[model samples]
Target chain A: MSEDKFDAIVVGGGLAGTVAAYLMANAGLEVVLIERGNFPGSKNMTGGRLYTHSIEKIIPGFTAEAPLERKITRECVTMLTDDSAVGLDYRSTRLGKQGSDSYSVLTSVLDQWLADKAEEAGAQIIAGISIENLIVREGRVCGVIAGDDELEANVTILADGANSLLAQKIGMRAEFKPSQVAVGVKELIRLPASVIEDRFCSSDGEGTASLFVGSPTAGSIGGGFLYTNKESVSLGIVATLSTLVEGNRSAPAMLEALKRHHAVAPLIKNGKLLEYSGHIVLEGGYDMIPKLIGDGVLVVGDGAGFCMNLGYAVRGMDLAIASAECAAKAVIEASGQGDFSAESLAVYRTLLEQGFVLKDMKTYRRFPHFMDSTPRLFDEYPRLAADTMEEMFVVDGRPSIPLRKAVMPHLKRIGIGTLIKDVRKGLGSL
Target chain B: MMEYVDVDEKLAVDKFYVDEDNAHIVLRELGPGDMMQFHTLELACPAGLYECLPDGTVRFDYAGCLECGTCRILCGTTILEKWEFPRGTFGVEYRYG
Candidate 1:
């Protein structure tokens, strides 16, 4: 046991933990961060792209020095059937502008950079040590216990990732329901920088992000994502655990099928597989947020279920940054008053509620339900799009009719009433 | 007709630093109908570490685990006797995650 009690102890050295350590240590507080991985990101994985809006507020012009892959200048959404694809590709300079910018990131490099920033700010980082238990005296968390060592602190922050067993151990959160989370399996495929740019239709230092519906998950309640990196591409599929458990396709099989799909095979024709990874992402939205603040304790990042998936955009890093900021602010305030009680720490929730973290989550609260209930979005819609596209483009000896007349039969196959109902529910949820 | 790669071939590209001292995951003894329950792991484990054997049993190797926690979240304590991440500096490391 250490007799010297630090001001704050952060468990798990990922995005949220490192950010909190950086903030508190920068404010001249005694902070220590513990990581179970050999380094910061050895245990992390993502789809994954980072929205720069929140991180920009933390480190202005971060893209200048950060280990970022590429600025996303092109956006694509493709509806794919087994043999056909209908895509909407949008490219504009507006996307690369300051606040709206995003980048595809590989966390192994990004998280190490963040840990360096926190260390530079005077936070002591202890790596390769798993926290075995929380030191709770009279219902208040005072520090953490790792094996035979007990490190004491005035406040403890749990920034552990998606499967936060520590929070559940303390009764602060419940076990994950299968429907509340999704599994993402990814492959990082290597290609030459020039080859990637030529294939994705991008200039140097810029890339594209594409999302797929239909054939990727084989009619499951999930989708596929692809992000172009400097010399590689991140491609994966995410399906809800509930749906995955009930389905016949294994996650690895789904990824294999996605790679072999005609719509995707050409993009990585000669590429070599660099790394394959898997992770669980919280998709339960606002309703899944657990008890965040307690006496001398706080939860941030995926531990608190701070991730959102809006069909077109998937965000977790931004929300992790914002939540860490709010928690840091509240901790800094509490440290000044020497009051680390639950009442004093309640400011963390207040700050999150007032900021975009909670506001944006609230706006899209029903989206997960909307997706889970609508099966046709993954099945019929792609078939309909593919059939309609074939009607107009596949030229046989037959004369083509008017565009509406040609498309109406395909629409009728899905029933106008069902289509209208789905649209209404989808619009209402969004 | 597209041919798919085997799960082992897909996982071959990944790297894992194993913990020799610890068996991070273990399966409980199977009773009647337990094999079917264990078979779900064969369908859901991203690394395909679990296999239902011909003798009405399941086999699992934790060496190549991605530590994604899908098995833990799905099977809970039912089929798994013990499950935790490999102690520090061990388990699968994602170089390009």
Candidate 2:
């Protein structure tokens, strides 16, 4: 018997929505998960890493079954300036532990798996349909309109995405500023598994996550990332829409420049191109979070802006999964009271406040501002690092200067005060 | 031996703009609104899905688009200007993604 009505309607079959549906349905509430893609992941993309701490709590030991790409055991951060690159590398066996390590999986693969889990948990999964409108009556969301179908629910979860028009349609989220978002352009380059492992200096199944600052974005506010997969590498650049536009560099052009970079080209020197995707990522942290709760409705994932870019690390998947858990728990508690008003749904905020989702965002609240305001870190700093390293290594026997004497001129050019001030600001923010 | 990424192979797999009508059709009907608003979008379109007409009306070719979401976001008409995943298992299927 298809009841046509559900306890909750979860929009967007990505990690947050599917996990929320999975949990709520497991808790004995009827759930319907909706996705516009033909399948769960057809429309999605990412930097391709999922930090699994949160997901492990809900679906324990799930990694044994998930389509994981590689276990990241080596971390590399490269500062590039065309012909030169200065890198910091760290390798540790500690990163390979289950429930703590992160892996790179395409969203198309991961989201489909999550949706299947929700479906297996008795939540109805609906694909190949876009929710055209929210069914609101008397200031409360009650159902959704998809094409000719109108399905009713007691509560609605809007986890659609960063440019979620559905959240804005109900006046639940406001128009975001350009500075509040970034446009990420990505290319998945396919190399052999052995070639990938050898190039990244990783063991057979292990992989590396490389982040590039400076030349990737043509000295823009954003940076580039590369994560090794089983037989390919995920490489891309994320630039603030404002900066990319003002800097007169297309996101595609920036990605091309990054691929041609002397330090980046050799890694995938003979690989075939696999896929390309562009996504609008939420850049603004705590400050950009819109109204999270409303009558019979709650927002999660990128719609709620749960992503954080803290220079060294860019995280969204774990945060998405975490938000899903909190949202599910909140919905369950609300259903227990038989109340679906804003007052009842406020439990979502409380759970986020007590969890890592909000805590991490609050900690990095000042970092985005620092990154945006400090342009020198992108332009001058990478060149200085590369130049200083080159000066130290060159021994032409033509009167070699002392180490400090060699580096002082470059430091003096940017001034010691600016470097000191930037360090202080970076420390204070991070 | 090429020093760059083969985006054409990627473009071959990924689908293009989807909506009630072609994106450029909707944008044209909505009017460019402002040329400056179209600048970022015009430059950022990786698939080169668009072109400008003689008098400055932007002409769009939806074939081989990477569907990067830039034109939709950078458009003054906003994301409402019709860009979606091609219907039902029709877009890029990643081999290693």
Candidate 3:
């Protein structure tokens, strides 16, 4: 092969890399994007929700032509126990209009389409090539070498996924401890559109996303999520790696247990299992994020641990894109000055901190730690509350006590003092 | 409807086994005849027990095996032994690990 020099080399063709390549190429820079998979998103997976704001910034008004499955119109958070579930559901027709803020997207379809957009903008994407290592010269990363091919560039961007080998190779991140990561296993269950709509109580083209906090992981320190697709449902469980190790459970067994749950079985009763996939997620909030910018390279997406699992939704893809866009802008600035030093790349960190990508992470940095230490909130509290309510409202032949009396006994049974402490901790963390 | 016959026509032996001394343990057959059974077991250990290969395969050290089977499930292929260490020392000892 010929040795070609580009202005920038992007290692990883996921959403972050593709967006960076797109922006750089549009700005009239020669860029090459190397992907390990057969295509941009062949090995990618998510819970099927994409925020429109960040994506629109990259490609304006993409929803009109993008491969979007459904507009998210309703969101539900269910606190479940062994026998009952207490849910908070919200539906808004305002979020289902032509220009919605978010939509459910299949990553395989969306990433492929985004790659096409990047290629249209003159970014050369070479797929099915695994980047072996970063070409470091004098303690500075200058390019990437992939399997007998050495590509030279002024700067290299690492947009590899959570289990990023490139970032580890360059010493941008250390070996991830189990506490800082999570293993998520998801299944795309195929069902008729009508059946999905009825099951989720959604209309045509309107979707629902539900989050579960208990029984799914079997009292582990993680949660479960179910997102509605066009003709399928994306259901999965994400547990802290440390929790999974401590609990002696496997992700597949947890998924099977979730499917067997009384509260979850009815929604996927007759659905066909179309595909099963699993991926690692960095869930340690802001504290677990690695060095964003190095001497001659910048890391984006899960490589930098830019994910927020806020008990209600997972917001990493948009943050990844936003961070990549910030890095692209920094690259443009660095290119003008002909400098690719650590000082020049520090602008990427400043931009991310100014945006919601890091600000939100810092705001809820204590969430994962708090959730891990409080298992009773996920398992016992919800059940006790539901049982108390059931007893108060059942009203058999026997005389019924006051509502306050029924609730107080249950609260006392679980130690009201500890419950209050947990509430305080939860409120503080949120 | 098409009728299916059992390929192994020998007497169906009771595959369920239990250690009489250990009441907490019970093992049962996972599949019918001519099928490989994959048993999952969990053990605790610190890091450095396994190494991830270039082709995304992980090799476990026999002496430091935790027997977690995390490597097996993450491999995405069924061409692994996925075994455990012997019931003795030379394994993981996790204390607040």
Candidate 4:
């Protein structure tokens, strides 16, 4: 609670803020990180997996010390109907290889660990304080005004998350559109580690990541996800806000349905519900990125919409980490030059563009639009898979039919032309 | 209609360190037919705090709020008078976020 100015003030103690503070403070810059929650990740929720590539660069071999739940060795994508599920389950050693591996995480623990790392690197960590507004003087961002305290800094970073009111206050970002964001509700179900290993068919410290489409969302423009923790399971449903507003089913109800699904219920049987949390996800891909650099200020993480929801995978934390690295590099360079103007802060954008943060985003810029336009992926495709599977697997005392003939009706139902068009667009978007 | 999981029971299982004096979320006065627009909150709020009464009104409780900000985005300035994170350390703290 010092009135003195610091070199940099980082807002929101999520992944982005902590990483930026860690890097800046490690470079001997006086940095302060302000967190609204009692702790860094207390108010955070995720579908629960982090791609290790971005973070490995920041702290090499971080898996040894990080509070990661389990290394994901099995990947699944199940197209689920009410009573049927068609899934592709891939279990391979390649998935657990170093530098490419991912782990299921509880951010409440993971973010706190990272925040501690930032503090150990000599950053002033302040928790349990909401930043009311930015202290913008003469059109140049000075720092933040939290309650009665006005903390000044030569540079300010907004890592406040998807619903950043402070960034909106300074017009650095705009309010999220219902289409650009999604609502995710989750339940952490606790079970014995041995039970989880037996249920998910994994060995010790190994886990499975599963995604479901169709009935879990009641065939909406979203899906369901489940990640195996060491002694618990992270199960949840995510639906686009626009569709949730229009649909009759609530997110919690969808989650409950997912928990009750014939294929999913058996997986979490006898487990106790440990926690229930909900969050807004930035799913608009690259198109949703708002202004990242302004006079004496920078925006990172979900605040800048650095998230992507590919049908097979959802990524935000890694992008947040990468973006924070870029911002920190830019800030250190700016500090050396003694310039905090918008022009100098523009280096953050260039760094992101040159790195995986913006490159990957730009590569998949058309994805969100594709997912929005393609309704059949959620509804018709799952039903088609179920029907196709029933035709092939269900043995009845009837005349034998050709395999192609058995699947022809389902294909005709979805129309071959429409399927081809969707395939082409999906591939092109990717 | 699909059966929804009992939200109250689900919320009861979670933790909320409530700040009784402050209601972080407040509703604006409703005009004619404004209640219809609020039915969306019933669908969006994961906590199930926003309830549309049969008598053409809405009932809300901030105690169980997950602070996901869905209602804030969906309603915006139209239906909400004020929506801020309950002063730090006073709202829902996810034990395993």
Candidate 5:
């Protein structure tokens, strides 16, 4: 068969791949974006609140034309014990306005839009083609072999989502251990617009994104999330595979249990279940990120494990978009020099390192381990707080002691001194 | 097998928030272990399409899926099934995914 060569061949047409392809093509380079899916976004899902800063940086005024569900106005963090929860909430008027914090979106729609942008910018996107391996020539990367066809390019980009086999095949990413990744299962339950507004307590076109602890997984490491969409709620559970396997549990069941949680049920109650999906997320943070660049190849998005789930908000798509832009910029520079060797592609890693992608990952590298070591924050503390609250509030004809006095014993029972130490460690890690 | 505690029972013991308006609700802290758990959950769902069979079961299909989450979300209360897209990198490629 004949080889079809181009200035660049981008494998896995997700956010990172699409953005890179779009940028390259717009800069007047020949680019081919290969996607294994029938279409862009057909198989993608996220708890998915899109951070607009990076996206707007790539495509200015995106909020006006992007398929946005709602501008997030409220955010909450809930600590749970099987049946009850205590939460911290933040809501601001400024957050509800456009071009502000972020918007909750479905990746399917958003990705399709992005791919179209790439197409409009003159990149050729071929969907439903599975790329089996990378074409490495003379120890310098060259292109990709999809089935029987060899597609050559000056540079090839692997944006093939979190489980990025292309990167693995090319030796850029090592075989992933269970600890280096996360499994997230999400349900898109269709609720009436009014119900969603009333349930989450948001005004028209305003939404809330909340994170949960406890009920989603039995004592395993991971959490649950719920993000309000235009007419539905995206609810899901996520946990580590090693822990799940060690604990002998299942993820879908865990997601159901999360939906069954008292705090989550009413919001989803009576809502029709529309769609459910899941995907593995690279939670390896900075420590697990693989070699990002090599001869004729660059890695971006979850393929590079560029997500930061800091327990406040899950920020992967924004990082993916940023990294893709960086890769595109690097590829553009490489094309100008007519070189695609490791030296030329090293710019991708350099740009990412200088940006928040690597900087923030470095900052919070210790957080995952610290949180893992202290399971009590999820298991013990919530129970203690609940006990204290109950003891301090109920009136049953006993001598009425001061609320503070009533709760002191419960605090002692759970070892408040230890709790304080954990908090100190957590603050330091974060 | 130990009797599994109801979400409400667990919540009562832990002091998780129960929206009097809602049922079986509780919130807990997330740690590294939880993050790993999330990753596993994510793989099980795989683009939110298809079902995960019981242990030692393998299934793959390239077509007949409506891109729905039926088999996945409702496994066994519905019956376990697998409906995967192409291997070696297949399924949705969201520009934003």
Candidate 6:
């Protein structure tokens, strides 16, 4: 019965937890991963894209056997202003290249695939249980209390999703602020695979990852996104929670409005809505990162607020995977040294600093702040972009004007100083 | 509330453990003289299952709930006191997720 106490006990069976468990189990450690749902991915949610660079670092040939939706080789960023739309569409064969490319994934299947990988590597998965609290002794977390069972471990990892309750109960995480988190609501619309291909202009098994700003949130400080799966599309909006209630715009209403918008309706015109899923997203970058290591305990993935939403793209799964790998490495090293002290487990932070996970997050730390303060980026800028495009293309039986002459006033409305300042700031942050 | 998007047939299958009388969730059941401050209940529901009755009671067809928790939050279930994830292996199983 003493052997029941595993080397490591992982709470939450999402991508981060599963990845960490897999890596640690692969390192020949006894790992038990617990999930509240019947399966790992059952409770996971994503806006539908996975940047594969980090995953490749772990499993070199993961995509060969992984359950993936599509290789997102084509991308679009659209700015919508009520009746107008300005789109920037770019496709490259290079995006389809092996290492640097990304793909759209349904978390339901993807999470299970990853958890299965960990199981294959000897991680024991305890499903259908929700851990209520951490078992702390002598100021160190040694296990978790789930229902009537107290499963012990040398080290316990919190890989639960954003704003983890267990982490908060242990005084490791803060009560999430509405300003720091965004509520994302997504709908899966099923279309014929060929229809999706033709509509998004991807003929050869490639897909589109498109984002929308402005009217999706009714010009609030949030945006909408669309990612094409093989036979369906994941379309949704993520609004800063701070702006929801006072602004009188609920997330579901915003989604309803988004689906009915003329600019967006055609994208999923004849499709069937497969699912409606919503989750809170952490938009807080570096400043929001909690104290990651504690005595005999560590936190990884969303529990540590490792997601980055840079407006153009949102990345968490890869960061979660990458950070979990680091956490697993730190845990493995600490256990081998027979030390799980907070001082010893601090190596996890070092691993993150050494890896691209924390480094990339630090780079974009200022971006979320920029997003929060700049209302024009969501409202004025998108309209300006759409209006500028409308002016450029519309031939109203008037004499053609020089391109600069036509576009200058729109730029002038948003002063040249503002544009330059924003450009410089954007470049600096990204 | 109004027809916006056509939901999949799978949502019609009920997966939640709900007690109608003791729902624990709070929603504004409009009265005869009350002007709807906002159609919040209708807006939060994506599957269009909520119907306002003549006596101001709401007929919410929770069977079609997607469990998105949008309405759960908007309806004043702070910290999700009333909402719980449907039991293991129940609820909408996203084939595509």
Kindly indicate the candidate among 1 and 3 with the higher TM-score.
Answer: 1
Q: Write the per-residue lDDT of candidate 5 for residues A288-317, one digit (tens) a residue.
A: 898888888888998898988776778899
TM-score of each: 0.97, 0.93, 0.82, 0.98, 0.83, 0.88
Q: Candidate 6 clashing pairs?
A: none
Residue A332, model 1: lDDT of: 96
> Candidate 5: where are CA atoms >4 Å away?
A96-100, B1-97
Across A121-167, the per-residue lDDT of candidate 6 in tens digits comes to 99999887778789999899989886577989989999987847678
Q: What local lDDT does model 3 show for residue A298?
A: 90
Q: Is candidate 1 or candidate 4 better by TM-score?
A: 4
Q: Worst ten-residue run, lDDT, model 6 chain A? A: A241-250
TM-score of chain A of each: 0.98, 0.98, 0.96, 0.99, 0.96, 0.96
Give candidate 3 regions above 4 Å deviation: A94-100, B1-97
**What order do candidates take by DockQ, descending?**
4, 1, 2, 6, 5, 3
Model 4: per-residue lDDT, tens digit, B15-92? Answer: 888989999999888887776568778887888888766686678899999988999998876788899988978898
Better of 2 and 5 by DockQ: 2
Q: Write the per-residue lDDT of candidate 4 for residues A281-350, one digit (tens) a residue.
A: 8899888888899888999998999998889988999999999999999999999999999999899999
Docking category for candidate 4? medium
How close to the true structure is residue A338 of candidate 5, measured as C-alpha lDDT?
90
The global C-alpha lDDT for each of the candidates, from Candidate 1 onward, is: 0.88, 0.81, 0.72, 0.90, 0.73, 0.79
What ordering of candidates by TM-score runs from best to worst? Answer: 4, 1, 2, 6, 5, 3
Which CAPRI category fits model 5?
incorrect
Model 2 chain A lowest lDDT segment of ten = A242-251
State residue B29's C-alpha deviation in candidate 6, in Å: 13
Provide the lowest-lDDT 10-residue window in model 4 chain A.
A243-252
Q: How well does candidate 1 match the true structure in TM-score terms?
A: 0.97
* DockQ of each model vs. true complex: 0.60, 0.34, 0.04, 0.74, 0.12, 0.25
Stretches of candidate 1 exceeding 4 Å from the true structure: A399-406, B1-5, B54-56
Best by TM-score: 4
